[model samples]
Target: MHRIAILLSTLCCAVTLMAQPALPPVFAQTDAARMRADAITRFYLAPVRVMQSHGATRPEVLTRITNGQTELGRNGMCLLSNAEGDTASITLDYGRELHGGLRLTLGSSSRPEPSLVRIRFGESVQECMSDTRNTKPCVGYSTDDHAKRDIVVEIPRDGQMEIGNTGFRFVRIDLLRTGVTVAIKEAAAIFRYRDLPYVGSFSCSDSRLDSIWLTGAYTVQLCMQEFLWDGIKRDRLVWIGDMHPEVATINAVFGYSDVVPSSLDFACSEFPLPRWLNNIPAYSLWYLIIQHDWWMHHADRALLERHRDYITQLVDQIDLTVDSVGRFRANVFLDWPSSADKAGVRIGVQALTVWSMDAAAKLCRILGDSAREDKCRAVARRISSHIATPKKLRQAAALMVIAGCMDAGDMAERYMHGIDGFSTFYGYYMLEALAMAGRYDDAFDAISRYWGGMLDLGATTFWEDYDPAWGSNANRIDEIGDPARKNVHGDFGAYCYPGFRGSLCHGWASGPTAWLSRHVLGFEVVQPGCRTLRIRPHLGHLDWAEGSYPTPYGAVKVRHERTAGGHIKTTILAKPRGVKVITDR
Candidate 1:
């Protein structure tokens, strides 16, 4: 009953059932709607609040930072002007998580020499407030790896210094000098981002859904720096597996950015076969899937053609690993939670292989390699024959459904039962699986409750790992660590992102954005390169919704409103050209 209808670029209905669905959501409020920002740019933001100040002559010194006064000397704010030996520190809240560093403009110091200071960048207020101490497995801790969250630097007298080069919303500055007083000209957040246009967008009658869509878009946008990183704070690398949802988000919003293809290219070169992408067997499957999804969106064969040899070879290599039976013998580590369940992992891995092989067969056919296509189809059929039980695990079950090895309705029921425990990485598939079963309400509610939970936690960007139950006794990320309340950011994480090391802005968690765009606004690519689309509106609860779908021709703006008689009145705001759009009237 729910399909997010998108506007058609109307041309001709040339494609059929072989087509795939579109993805995710984005509403940059006004900025996203108006794509003005450069591909990669920076914006300076001043502190909204001064959390702490020690040994300060002027109590309101740093508080005046909101004025954005970068004037050197004169009545400029003096953060710390201590004659006696005292630990002078000032913590600032930039109000939101951003991908950049801190910039401090020094007016003039009492001493002619440079003044040494320690800068700590944190995704959470609690993380920025603390030093690199008390790091344990389960307990939270801070470090300066990949991107420097903590660093010590010197500010030359009457000069400017930009320090951090990571993702952070809070900054802690500690003065290490006794007699020297440093006057700050300006201290602002150097907000860095790509100048790319927010090509795709989604906004419903619900504000919560709007924010969730925006947050997911912004999260992926932040991760789209030099490459499509998994997270900005941690796991700051081009992880092939994590890029699946990210690529979907890119398709939904940014539309054909080089980051996706470049990162995919990097994944191919960086983690070549035999090693498997990221040394994980499943990640290799993700690589193929990414190519397929990218093909569906931009329909650029250059990527497929560039990695032509590798694609065929990878499929061949995968075939060698399979035995006479369709059972994938590899211990497919799907995700941390799914991996814990070995049997579930077996189901997920087998289905995922079939899914990837399906993509490979199509890709091979496009490349006009019928021999390879036939081989891929045979392999997929064999894998499809051996279906392992999902063991009620939602991720595995979702994977099974997506691969056509399991019934979507059965998996959708299991998915709702354990709504709290969904893999951010695989949540996209779960939503897709739910939609496949015609459970649009289930998918919609899932996206709202789960993805919206992050927004409720005062998250400007999504986290690497999340559990709705975690917010029960958890402190908001914006707030300082309250001993009375649970340390939300500092504590409560498992596997790779444990404790303070957990990334608050992971792109993998941004699946809901794309999910909303595809299922809710419904601009599915039934043909490669959006040659043909099936536009359906699945607005379950919302009265009205409107958004644009990014396509090769241009943005197709579509709107859906509920009539008094409980019927949807659909309208195509923009005119079409080369593409065909199919709708259920």
Candidate 2:
């Protein structure tokens, strides 16, 4: 017995000595970090606001605030003062040296609003006069692809000025420095549809209208008419609403609709989305982490662990109440504050839940916590099993995948109602999930149906809403429009074609099309920050489509060539995948 005990002790000591030392936390690679930053910026595209008809009817001053003269400096603010009559001075200040200069755009609406304007600046400053001829009027049905060529101004020293003959009705100054102020000495021009339904309402205490306010209202109608139309652009399975200007502003200022409770000093009433219309914080938190991981192409285990307890506890409490079908049985009918439960028990909720668990499991594996990994895996399997097989559920879940893969469980055909489908609200999601799941045929059929329908409608830019076939209540707007409120698409002309006509050339919906142009056309972006570049491309329809875009890294161009096989062979200008490639499929 003594000999056996000694041997056991020796073995234990040897095993302990053989263990490897802990590895230090490796910060994300520079390229990865750059990619992540790019994704983050794109994911949260900053909305630019400007005066619409400043020079048309009213006399106004166009101010260019450089990074050096603005109150917060860094071109953070620009002040446009309407002299209240014949003359006005637009003051531009960048305040201090610590602040850097940023680009600002100034322009008239698409319809020419002529005004003789002059540029002036401090003695040390250069390029005080903005070249109105070069400023591309904020025109076009779709501003998504438009360049920011309006008033390109850099904050120089203490003073910069741009004066115009007409009282300006609209002026858009980019946030270049902190406390960027625009004071109009003249009376601002009033909008014609200021009191229409869904026109304008909603903003932070600062009362800045989101760039998408007009677009949202215009698209809301279409979304209601046919869900997938918007889905094609928004990606139903993902949280695209967070990208809207008003939505972003509200969430940033008031706290994300779901998790506002966690943050103190946030008055719930201060937010626009009532508690009843918002999502649960846990959902947002989980989705945020998963999104970060998916787009950034990495798992931050330490970060995950830091929030593990809170996430785990909240999920645990949630699970206790949810039934086998994934419904909150106890509060099934009882709605939470600011929560939207329109698609209850559908794949939308399940997809996020499953994804979060899957992500957690990945983190656990990376952290060398086999036990926790097992736990997360088991939960993931359970959720997947419950969510993936039903006709409606499967189609919905497939959309959640975003890879456009399809499988046996897919029942998109079963849910099709000619014009609308059970999954209409999630167009892009349907394509992505079907692709990821390898349900290529179904995904193709659905895309064809949607594309054909849009073509039939003479759609230059995709609408915000539509049925499975782009038919039905095809109007692209919500019922609410009032100039007093900061509503999307109700009052502004951002989504209008050439900034004059109301139409569906929307920026948000175009993003998905860009993805398809890359994915289906097989075009890949290879540059470092230019992850969206394209070399090889194919378009199913249209004479010839070619366009170049400026990305953080560089420029990308997309071109397509038809082939007999009908499948596009793509060539990437650069390699998008850096150290590793992630295949969710």
Q: lDDT values of the candidates?
A: 0.80, 0.32
Candidate 2 residue lDDT tens string, 1-585: 223224334644554475454334585445454532110000001112222332222222323222222232323222333333433333332211000112233332111322233332210011121222223424322121222223434433333343221111122333233222232222222111111112112211111111122223323222221111122122222223322212222211122122212121122222222221124533332433342332222133344455454445434544454456654333221112112433533444555555556656655555566776666556555556665433444334443453222242443444432324322224544455544444544554555466335434433334343333223433212211233443222222332122312223332333233234334433342422233333443343432333333333223333443447665433233322332112111
lDDT per residue as tens, model 1, 274-388: 7788888889999999999899887888888999999999888888877778877665788876767888788788888989999999899999999999988888888877676
TM-score to true structure, per model: 0.90, 0.40
Q: Which stretches of candidate 1 lie over 4 Å from their true place?
A: 1-39, 57-74, 83-85, 133-138
Could you give the C-alpha RMSD of every candidate to the true structure, in order shown? 8.8, 19.8
Best by the lDDT measure: 1
lDDT score at residue 545, model 2, on the 0-100 scale: 37
RMSD of 1: 8.8
Ten consecutive residues with minimal summed lDDT in candidate 1? Answer: 1-10
Error of 2 at 114 (Å): 25
TM-score of 2: 0.40
Model 1 TM-score, all chains together: 0.90
Tell me the spans in candidate 2 whose CA falls farther than 4 Å from its real position: 1-348, 384-409, 416-425, 434-514, 521-568, 576-585
Per-residue lDDT of 252 in model 2: 16
